[model samples]
Target: MLSIFLTIPLTMHSQSLFEYQWKNRLIVIFTETSNSREFQKQMQILNQNQNQAGLNDRKIKVIHVIPDKHQIVFPEKSGWQNSNLYQKKESKIDFEVILIGLDGGVKLRETNPVEIEKLFDLIDSMPMRKAEMRRNDN
Candidate 1:
């Protein structure tokens, strides 16, 4: 159930993340640019097909939010989207990572590049995800 709902003009300046609420868990990387070192490393860590698979298994989408450039990048989308939607809401930090759950709750927040294993472990521990896995296993 890869939700590839590729709508254009990703610059919606509203408080609601309603579009991603029920369907996808989200990893939001807040950085100054696509080239930011921490951002690069974080993106690189998840660049593998297996890592991507892990994310898909958990119904997760990685989004790069570059407030300085007024852009947010969606994994399912082709290019960077011009938007200030995620700017300043989390903070003015140069780099930060946020893990959002399917229910639109902030599951984890970190000032450094996230460890994928840690992220996966947290998700796997969640009751919702445990049920999801049980259904899949059955």
Candidate 2:
């Protein structure tokens, strides 16, 4: 596994998805608008499990993207834009949750709100996470 402290910050803009690519595992919430019920439910699950056993110690970051609103909300702040990060050809019209790994790859994608336990299990099963655990034990 790559050393956590060695990751680089990619960039800053109306959307900063790449900024977290190598530094933290990202749970990106993409919605048509911030008012979606599914988005709310997913956010609630993340909030509830953020500090729980399987997730707390891991470097996880959350990014909320609302294409209709042209906004991106990070944990500490949010940004608004006239244009969206999702282009017309690549955008998903429905609500979606995307889990990006520290290696800058999409690890998981779901159309429905996910349970925290399930998310944790998926994350814990990753090879990088397994190596992290081994390193910590030593």
Candidate 3:
């Protein structure tokens, strides 16, 4: 399994979003508005399983973006921004969730809330995750 804790950069920038999450899986959540019900549901599921997802060891980083409102919420803080970066990655739908692998590529996208188990299972199946697991076994 992937390691439990990894060092993230001290700074965050829209231009280098993926660069900061270079070796970590990213869970990007986009909503039409900050108060959207779907967004709340997604947050709840993720928050509840924060420690349980990703091979029982990996801790996913979550980025909540309300593009319509030009706001972004990080796990440790929140701020206002143009939303161009997130908007470009979002689907046409108003509410969407994207899972990006450690390789900095989007692995999954959903228009509705996704169960934690489903997300964990997907991560556990990744080749990189398998390699991490094997390495940990020894």
Best by lDDT: 1
Q: Candidate 2, which segments miss by more than 4 Å at Cα?
A: 1-15, 49-54, 68-75, 79-83, 88-93
Worst 10 residues of 2 by lDDT: 4-13
Off by over 4 Å in 3: 1-14, 49-56, 68-75, 78-82
Tens-digit per-residue lDDT, 1-138, candidate 2: 333222212222334555765578877777777788998888677776444444546777776766534544434445665545444213345777767787776667788998987777888899989888899999
- Which wins on lDDT, candidate 1 or candidate 3? 1
Task: Write down the worst ten-residue block by lDDT for model 1.
Answer: 1-10
For candidate 3, lDDT tens digit of each residue in 1-138? 222122222113344454645566777777777788998888777666454444236546677776533433434445665546444643578888877777666678789999988888898889988888899899
Better of 2 and 3 by TM-score: 3
The reply for model 1, stretches above 4 Å from the true place, is 1-16, 68-75
Candidate 3 TM-score, true structure as reference: 0.74
